[model samples]
Target: MSDELDLLRAADPAPAGEGPWRDRPLDARAERGLNRLLHSRRTRRAGRRLMLRAEAAVLALFAVLAFTFSDAGSSPAVAAPVALVVHDAAPPLSLDALARSAEARARTAGAADGPHRGSHLQSWYMSMESGPDAAPPVTVPEERITRWNADGSGSELVVATDPRHPGRPVIHDDHGRWRTVSDGKVLHRKSYPAGSAAQHGGLTARTKPPTDPEALRAHLAQLYGGADGTSTTPQLLLALSSFRQEWTPGPRETAAIVRMLADADGLRPAGTVIDRLGRRGQAYVYDDPDGPDGASDATRQMVILDPRSGQLLGLEITFTKDQPDFKITAGEVMSYEAWLP
Candidate 1:
């Protein structure tokens, strides 16, 4: 029992090259949270052997989780960290013009009357298996839905099912350890807390996004930029993750964001492709480096968009180099997500 837990003693995610969100450190408070998560009763339950490994695997994953996702005692187990993908070189297209087209379509449609409509986010997120040095990886196909009420309350529900089994979702027991159950109808859920960031970065009513491109750029820079106060590719990626993650955006805002992305560094047109939801979208590739050494652990992040309607279709990420310690092969998808239409 102590031997299996030795893996939990890891202070940093092994193979520094593999942990993606390397921007921050795990502080003492976060460490205590991990301790609680590891020592929970469910880790020793009879049927949760696989679940125990998963909880440890997730610890390996979040060791480098940014402070934004980690609270003192309560840890957010539901964060998809930085990601990228590696694929064929693409011919550059007039992404700016495409963004303009989408924006015009949004203006024509006008503002939606109520909260963003109910939409489901689906993805194959990478999950790790705790091992000797680095953890072995598995693809967790997850389904997510976030909804806002007319009275301004909302909830996010996430159901992760093993692709091999398909219906059983990986869940956490009352003791806060991961468990897999046979019920297809059961799901894990959480609600949006007041004053915290909204899923996909929706600003409050007082801070609704300006539809103009320049203004949108400033907004993102202020919201997602780094220490030097400049917006980088990674910050923009986080901005995209926080604000537009599968939730429907206003057409003008969508158009503006698309234009902003078109001009952002490292975006290359990957041409039109089908998303996991089977929707056709134009793809853009962003290879972001995580460490000071140029190109070390650089990930290829593919963001799919429906240019015609100007909606973001989904995002996928993959490692670009060999992570031998973790047994991670080059080009293996780290995570993938699509919105159900």
Candidate 2:
């Protein structure tokens, strides 16, 4: 049994190269060849791994570019500008130049024509003051210019009062042509009627109503004190009715008002201030003269803002006397309407 086991062990081939197959222990040259084969296999595997990584990187870059381009393509197209056609013979003026010319025209015409000839009407109402021991406050009904018209040259502006009086219409014929007549008496008479048109140069027209209510209101407020204050409510209503009839505010007027307000310096001070209604962004609180006394009144102006653009909307003025002895008498809202040229 021992001889059989020894023969079987000897027949096992002497562990790869020890017997007949190798005839000797593996030499250094053979060992080197074997090592080279192993190295080649490892290098080939590493190369395959590197190639996979490179392919993945390239794929990732392409995916990023695809996403970017797709997103860009999905964006909306920009809107094109609309064309405007002018019928008058005058050359088209740039917005800025037109505004300057319009202002100059308004000033010159206002001076020549005298006060506006709109019907002067008013109504009275009573309300309580804010103080603990205060008397009832007097409030005049809302006064508005119902109708207004400008001569072809814009030299004469004829305005009919809301509460038109029983007499003849007020005429402001300052620029000749009987620009305006009130009860046979020419409220405004033009010295050089024929030549006055030349002073206005070319007549630029408005295309739409003014959108900025704030500036319009402020302008109207400034002009408020200059007009006649005595008239009936019905008459004033009539004047307001005329505003829609005679003058249609244009988009250019609105744009002009917005620009004016934006250009106004120091409209709001550095520090935060509460408005008359104690709300943020409601009113701009400022200082102004207080009637006869040297004392000053805190003037709070409520501004109407455009909801979409967050722009100044309109303005309301309220005067409160800081002096302990004096009472506040003026607190009114001034509204503005854009008149088309």
- lDDT values, one for every candidate: 0.53, 0.28
* Residue 152, model 2: Cα distance from true site in angstroms: 9.9
TM-score of 1: 0.62
What clash count goes with each model? 9, 39
Model 2 regions more than 4 Å off: 1-136, 143-145, 149-248, 269-295, 309-313, 323-326, 329-341
In candidate 1, what are the lDDT values of residues 159-229, reduced to their tens digit? 65433344544433222223444534435676765543333222321255667777866654433222012
Q: What is the C-alpha RMSD of each candidate to the true structure, in Å?
A: 13.4, 41.5
Report how far off residue 240 is in candidate 1 (Å).
0.8
TM, every model: 0.62, 0.26
Superposition error at 155 for model 2 (Å): 20
lDDT of 2: 0.28
